[model samples]
Target: MLGKAWQFARRHKTKIAAVSAITGGLVLAGKLAESKFKQWQEEETRKMLEQIKKQHHYENTEKTSNETLKSLFPALIKTIEKSLDSEPILERIKNQTGNKIELWNELKVLSFARALAMIITGTQLVLLLKLQLNILSGILYIKQPSQVLSSRLQERFMALSQNFISFSVPKICEQIREKMIQLLALSLKEKFTITQLEAFFQTTLLQLDLPGFQKLIIAPDGDHISQPLNPDEHLLLDDLINNIVELLEHEDYAKIFRIGLQTSLSNVFDYLAESYLSHESYKENGLRSEVRLPVAKLIPILNQSITVYQSVLHALIKHYTIREYSANIYESFCQAPPDAIAKPSLSTLWPF
Candidate 1:
């Protein structure tokens, strides 16, 4: 039996070696396959993480822009507050080489200019916001194709803008003119000193809370409900606020809106400065504190300055709210995939 087993072992040597080699190769191949699988999995995970990072960055940018738009009114108000600081105005007077008595009159004109800037800027912000809100309300509940919706919405927004310029501006300006007359007459009768007028202007301008005005303009229980709107229309207004806000969050619209609004405001400031400097009385007397304020003349000048900005506002509204631009915002929302759109909390029709 031992002799037979020894012979069998010797004969099977090559067969045993070949079988051993095959087993070893199979083990190595298994390890290689497992390693490749892990590499592929890691690569996929990295790609997914990158996508998520990109998405978060995009969302954050939009959110930041939207918040900036929302806070613009307050931001501009603060800017005016800083620009009109009494110290700087007084400093300008001190630095002047001309007669101090003549320079003193300049304070009244300067203060008036600053006050008008605040009022006009505030009014424009409010009016623009109101126009946007009204446009949103008009288009919110409409059921139509994107192209048709966009065209109709643009027409509606433009019509509202025209109405605002034609009817609203004059009426609002009249009220403003009357208020200015009263304020100026009272100041003159009291013989407000240059320092005292500066103080008054600063106090009055700083008291303007643009956000407070916004809340009054849009709040559900506020004066905007003078007309009897249906329940759905009321709800639509709330939804429209959200939609318009989200629309402004689009980066393109946000950038353009900011630039246009800032440009318009700057133009108004430049006009006011030029008008004041060119005034015959202003050039002659140099803003004499003792001089009577040309209240009637100043009111019309301020009204004209404010009226010119309406054109810029119209251009802005037309540029962004039209069908061509509106389609882009809708396209952006579509990029989020159908599954994301179907989610209840994320379901928003964000268009102008």
Candidate 2:
């Protein structure tokens, strides 16, 4: 009986343990499913509430918008009726504007009344200007050109010229010199090519109608022509014009041109010196020799180039009117001696 009980206990104990594990797993799965279903129901309830709230808000907005449009509809209809009625008003306004425009056209830019107004205005202006003359006469009286005021003005003019030479003219001269030199260099490079020079000589010396100067030999004027001449005479006559053209084309003539260019270029030194020496600053600085040396150096470069010579010559020469090197930097400024000297001397030069 004890052995049977032991065997029954062992077999039943294994079955009991397996049944308990299965029952526990089923209970856990049921609890998990219930929790998940509750969570899904709550989420669905929240989404449905959000959708209902949005729909309600959208319906309210649409109802308000419809009410506003209904409120404006009568005003819109009235505006349309008014616009439709304005066509005659528009036409009448256009006709009135056309009439006004014709009347305005008849009114000229100037007439008797305008001229009268202008005269009155000019007279008032002249009367107002008299105040300036009166004030000036009271302060700085000028009865005549020999008056103290006139003398003062003359002295001021001289001082102004001096100041310009001392301060302004140097810089102005530097700019002008730079511009002139640059223009000269460019003109030389462009205009004075050897090819152009040859063409110029050919045009000037060799007549286009008679390249061989046959007309000169034959005398187209029907005068001073020795007809039926000897062979030597014919040879001399025909050869004379050709000989001159040949001589002109000679290398010796080119050498002569170079020599002439050098001589003329050398004269430029005197010209520049004369111009520089005209300035009071040059005399004070004693830069005459300094100026001449540089000019002498520059003249030789011209000898090496006929282009340089012609360009400089072109810049120097004038037609109809003559030009002199006169600077007017102080034209607008009246520089009394005291005013010129009173200004800070260091103001002329600012160091960076």
Candidate 3:
């Protein structure tokens, strides 16, 4: 029976070959199409993941996470509190200024502002990235394989030929080849500004000198002030301090920083203290009284400023670490599904 069936198939070689070719072509095409579709899907998934990772890295540091935050917060708060020991300085500022109400009021405002800024900024940074991740996931997962293939084939084959016969086997195959190229190009160029912004902020933060608080401020000029040991000293200090400010103001960095300021009081105080301390003349005065002016009475201001600065720095580090962990969570969402749907099939040319 099998031999007779083989002979019958052989006798109708042209028809058999055509049918075989069609069958084989469909199977091969289906597999190839499936593979290509899967590849495209995976590539899209990978790209989205990379974007999420980039955004994560940018908006939040590697250190930001609940576990890390939990571990670090107590220690950080303790350190800041210890450094701030406001009692001695508060008394000094009150005695020297004789305007206790005004001075304390200003310190109170500054402290409050600082805390508010850090909380807000940190929250905004984390939330902004989270929203971006959600948007990206929706875009990546919403696509259907059949729809994509149909759309692609239509755009390619429709433009080439109108009639069925003109759409020869080889020609149709050629069209698929062309469509694949177009699809690849489109996928590669897809925009993700959130990722870009995140990357910018992360890179900028990495470049900042977090511990060099004293170097940021320059001392007021005086005959007693010591000259720079080297010719490059002034330039070095200027570059370092300028770099920090520059990083803070960068489009992406500024956006995250502003958001972070809104989330945490520490962040706001950090910004204020850093900005004020970076001035060249402030360090020169050394929070002391001058014969020409009673600015010496403002020593409490300097002390309070330092305390706020320390507190903000500690808080930022803690918050940053937590954000880093959150970014990792966003990254896990990028993996491709295992049981994806089947690809579309092409109808064959047959006589009615």
lDDT per residue for candidate 2 within 1-352, as digits (tens), equals 9999989879799888889999999999999999999999999999899667644543443343234333433332232223222234335445775564333222211111121121121121121122122222222211233432344333332232123223332233233233333322222113232233234323322222211211121112222222344454344334332333343344432333333333333433334345446655557787544332222232223222222223333322221111110001011111223212111112222121
TM-score, cand. 3 vs. native: 0.28
For each candidate in the order shown, give its overall lDDT on alpha carbons: 0.45, 0.32, 0.38
Model 3, CA-based lDDT: 0.38
Model 1, 183-278: lDDT tens digits are 543422243333343455445444434233223222223222234544644453444445444544445444444444455555554555555566
Would you give me the overall lDDT of model 1?
Answer: 0.45
lDDT of 1 at 340: 19
Show model 1 residue runs off by greater than 4 Å. 1-186, 189-203, 216-238, 245-266, 279-300, 307-352
- TM-score top scorer: 1
How well is each residue in 100-122 modelled by candidate 3, as lDDT tens digits? Answer: 64545444433322232223322
lDDT, residue 187, candidate 2: 21
Worst 10 residues of 1 by lDDT: 338-347
| Candidate achieving the largest lDDT | 1
Alpha carbon lDDT at 43, candidate 3: 100
Model 2, TM vs. native: 0.23
Candidate 1, residue 215: CA error in Å?
3.5
